[model samples]
Target: MKLFYEDVNLQTFQAKKTDEGTDQQGRRYVVLDHTAFYPTGGGQPHDTGLLNQARVYDVEEIDGTIRHYIEGTDPLLETVHGEIDWVRRFDHMQQHAGQHILSAAFENNFNLKTVSFHLGEEVCSIDLETDHVSEEVLKMAEEQANELVLENRPIETKWVSQEELQQYPLRKEVAVAGNIRLVIIPEADYNGCGGTHPTSTGQVGTIKILHTEKQRGQTRIYFVCGKRVNRQLGEKHDVLQSLTAKMSAPQEKLADAADRLLNQNKQLEKTVEELKNQLLTFEADQYQDSLVKAVFTDRPVAELQKLAKMIVEGNEEKIVLFVNETDEKLQLICGRSADSETDMNQLIKSVLPLINGRGGGKPDFAQGGGEKLMSAESLLEAWVKQL
Candidate 1:
């Protein structure tokens, strides 16, 4: 007997241990003649608790047999005392029932049907058969669902034969035809389902639609139910409080404060970049040699490219080779004036392998980085020899 299907609130039971074995992972498991534990199925996770002195971690129904994978107790015991983790089980019940109510709301009020559902660890999601769902649409569905919850309508489950199914207006067709199990909220939602649910809509507390995303031409709604709504509220409040303190703004003005700070940072970055380019151009104007070479400490390779480009552009027939060094690595950049036939790309390649580096570019410019096998001046001197 599956107590989960018959009595959703039944927390304890005594069952005969019919078989015991070790799986491929070496975890011990026992099959019982009867159990209250719910297996992992129908998008709902398995129930976990205790069997006598053992901790039941996972319960799975394989090939029509329920296996309660456990540890810490002797499997040889004939009669096992089982206890369900009511907290976990009841949370699942709340979320699952909320899903049905919310799904029905979208279908009945908006002509959108829920294609699928998932009861996650922190949130539940339902995929609707629509390309998009607007914020206003979500709010409408949420309000409708909560109204049903506030009404505290009775949630009834009935097992009916295929012939008797004609009397109830099922939201969807039954997957199995023989004994159809339906969870019904009278005048609200009637659907074929085997998952456990509470006795009334009030037990679900409230349904909150958190957000939505587009997936494969459908809209997936992410939400939390009952106590989870309060948990979500507390978590978000904590985040907002932390942000307000850091930004020195009141909760109501946090968004405006953040926007102003970001704009200030962007303006400062633009001014700094203009200053760097001016300094590089000034240094390039000081060099008069046709073959210009320089070495600097801890400069970025990107800046080296800027300095080399400036030098070549300022001189009619110049070839520039620049090197920068950090303690752990060396970087090089080579450039040439448009009038020069020198291949800066080939020139860098000739001595790059000596430092175990690899790079290539057009005939006029090239850049690369590698190990700091020598000083910045030594690297510059070596590249200058390639001229």
Candidate 2:
């Protein structure tokens, strides 16, 4: 096997085989020549390490070569020989193998291309170049893939001659003429894939298509198989337990409790609005007089504004004031009656200048806001004198 290294520090790179490879401070790293250790590529994360007879911490690829990142193995780095973690390696093989089976199944079922495939922590996903995946079709595809999984078909990988590659049907659209690697899962499917795979289909265990969604004009399928299914189930159980404690409800009654709370909140809002209307009506009656129709309130500014508009019938000589006692702001509006002699426009102009505010209107109506609640009683008395 040909190995390539650039700016290679052979001294800094260390090696060993251990489960928990490191102590507190430092660790070892193993650089391989043409490694079978799969570095993270094509959405699959890299493998963990085995150093000094323990499991190594992590495996990564730097510049196309596999590098084992060892933790506690540094002390034994000089004497210990490195080995790949085969259990984890085989698990990855099962997933990658299962992915090939499923990816081929999708391409065969829908004539859709697999754009990207990600083997994630809880689930593996295949992004297909189609916007929609109906439930019925998805179930059928899942059934077929599971059937193939049950068949326990032999999976073979080998480099084939260019002449031999022409005879077999390849799922990928691209063609390769030179040395080609093909993974053949007999009586099942074949594709141009560079990733590792299990020896047999049954090794994939049972695969479940958990969910799917449309993303970027494609259908992204979320799935789990083998040991991953158990992991996903364990995570879901833990989540439900946490929800039970956080919501302060038994597992079965949480949904009903949430629904009841939402309904009660809506009813409370309706009651609040009704009380506001009742208060507005009472406030309007207290401020009314024969020649002058007025509405004034020391409530929230928004509620005061709403009450002020409701008290006036847009007629008569009207003076409405809204005073927000908390925020210390006042709003005033004046309008003329049919027989009134007062100039409402001039009155607002004069009052606004005195209050350090700005307002204007025709002789019939004017409006403005200021911090003038202390002058409210005297201001109304003086303005009514003109009328």
What TM-score, computed on C-alpha atoms, does each candidate reach? 0.88, 0.58
Task: List where candidate 2 sits over 4 angstroms from the true fold.
Answer: 1-30, 34-36, 53-58, 71-79, 83-88, 161-163, 174-177, 234-387
Candidate 2 global Cα RMSD: 9.9
Candidate 2 lDDT for residue 234: 87
Question: Root-mean-square deviation of each candidate, in angstroms?
Answer: 2.9, 9.9
True lDDT of residue 155, candidate 2: 82
lDDT of 1: 0.90
Q: What shift in Å separates residue 181 of candidate 2 from its native position after superposition?
A: 2.4
State the lDDT at 56 in candidate 1. 91
Among all windows of 10 consecutive residues in model 1, the one with the lowest summed lDDT is: 71-80
Q: Report the C-alpha lDDT of model 1 over 1-387, residue by residue, as the tens digit.
A: 798887889999999999899889998899999999999987888899999989899999988899999976554579889999999999999999999999999999999998899999999999999998888899999999999999999999999999998998778788898988889999989998888889999999989999899999999999999899999999999999999999999999999999999999999999999999999889889889998888888887778788888899846899888787888888888889999999878998988887899888899899887887877788787787777
